[model samples]
Target: MRFDIPLPDDTARLEALAHLDGLVKPVGSLGRVEELAAWLAAAHGSMPPRPLDDVRVVVFAGDHGVSDPAGPHGAVSAYPREVTASMVRVFLAGTSGVTVLARQVGARVRVLDIAVDGELADVPAEVTAHKIRRGSGSIDVTDALAPGEAERALAAGMAVADAEIDAGADLLIPGDMGIGNSTVAATLVAAVLGLPAEDVVGTGTGVNEAGRARKVAAVRAALARTADRASDPLSTFTALGSACAAATAGFVLRAAERRTPVLLDGVFSCAAALVCAELAPEAPRWWLAGHRSTEPSQAFALKALGLTPLLDLGLRLGEGSGAVQAVPLLRSAQAVISEMGLLADLA
Candidate 1:
């Protein structure tokens, strides 16, 4: 439960900045790209960090009962809750947005079903080995998880990170797949940041105006329910966060613990990261905002985390697409820092 992880090496970052400045280019022509390289160097504690040869994307999939059309809250998503399971099949078939992008960058993709509502046929057992329940409870009226489920989901995420790192993943991207997840994520953000529902709720999954209003109302109710637990991270998560999001929080914490650079996708990732940062204040140093998601909560969460996004493409998709889109740019930054000739060498 206690992260207490070390921050990246500042000495290595300073040295990398010096090396970038000494490169055959203007003092700050590369802009944030230069900063990105320095960050990787610091994360690795080396002047020239290792190549991002093995990038891995882990998508945590689940269902939110609040999204159930039959539920009293009604569906706040454009898609039905059944789509969560269908999307998992698409991910397993390697045809999802995250999978396609990861393939383009030669990165591996693994979709874990942390709390999908129903059974998934033809899926590898490893994907569901950490399944905590059928689905998380509706946060608007009930706790997202029963007691002790949050801890199990967190441990599942940590184990997944360890396995990926042990398998030679140099870079990691945590994605999300679930209908109405944005509602769940926005609720978590509002609770942890003391923000009102209007500030955190958005048009998640292409919801209409009425749907957005419902979302805001739902978040407001959840906030009131968990207002007292906001100071305690675990209690807050248990009350307002989905199982997949709790797992995502654990994944972020463990990646920082291992000093592996992480590219955060969108609202889901950032909201979970907010909880992780509360758990370990130093964890955000090892993370980079992959892009500026259109999700209002994402922007607020990134601002809270003090991260600058590499791209601002108005992305609202949550399946790590934004992070994957920024991979080439990160690699270019890595190349400039690790391969560009020093000005003195040119002389």
Candidate 2:
């Protein structure tokens, strides 16, 4: 997969900086908020970006065989695999963490069952339209997806992004919902960054010490098995990531290609961003780290991408909760840029 993503507009960013300095405040009073305003302006290719009126958060749901209770290594997450489907229902019912926060920020939430292991009943057809498989292969012992399945998942993600942008979404947040996804995400990060398992593994979903050890072993095994493919982002993801993650990578890459800003949430999205950066080195220009997740892999990925996060709330809940929380802050920055008076006007 090839993407010729153009960097965000530099002229607009410089102009935004100058505008911020001219505002009725000290030159550096706003600190990071000013930086956020300039990034929005640059991403939108305007001095002051239009309000984030139609923000959309797309949650890519899936299942991982490595999390199977019957698998050789047993479950890696605190929650069972069935929770993936149950959370999908919760998201559809508009009661999940992301949904609740999205409402607060006036953003819409879309949940896609990309690789859910079980069939969801009584749900809208669009949610499962992009389903790649029941569950991804157990990455510790087998490839996460066949090459064809990986490509299809990526295409599905790109299509979803296009639809959202076409529907007038001003900002996008890519969320994730999958049991045992933390293991998959950590593995991908370890492989891409050439780090050891302990460096990236964490207590995903509040796993115990033994569970964390299991996750570390799984990540180490996955990295060793996929070592040769580490140089190729798609190949690495195909081996160590779930279909949902592949879709997330595709979604991020396409968003950057369209010059749309994306607020990345948690470790899964951070891992996906790493893969996208490998595919298109300039993709991070249109992306922002919504928060610093509790996952160590997220910190590693952010450092690698050279992007500082906006918040460090110790949030580990996936499904875009942290990003949704950060939405209001971005809007506040936009207000300062668009509505604040200039010092000259005060004179």
Summarize candidate 2's per-residue lDDT along 78-121 as a digit string, tens digits. 98899999999999999999999899888999999999987696
- How does residue 184 of candidate 2 score in lDDT? 89
Residues 1-347 of candidate 1 have per-residue lDDT tens digits of 67768879999999999999999988989998999889889999988977899999999999998887777667789998888999999999999988988889998999999999967967899889889988899888899999988888888898999999999999999999999899988987887788899988899888898999888888888788766653677777788998899899999889999989999999999999998888889899989999998889988899999998999998898899999989998899889998898889884
Candidate 2 off by > 4 Å: 228-230
Evaluate model 1: give its lDDT.
Answer: 0.89
> What is the alpha-carbon RMSD of candidate 1 to the true structure?
1.1
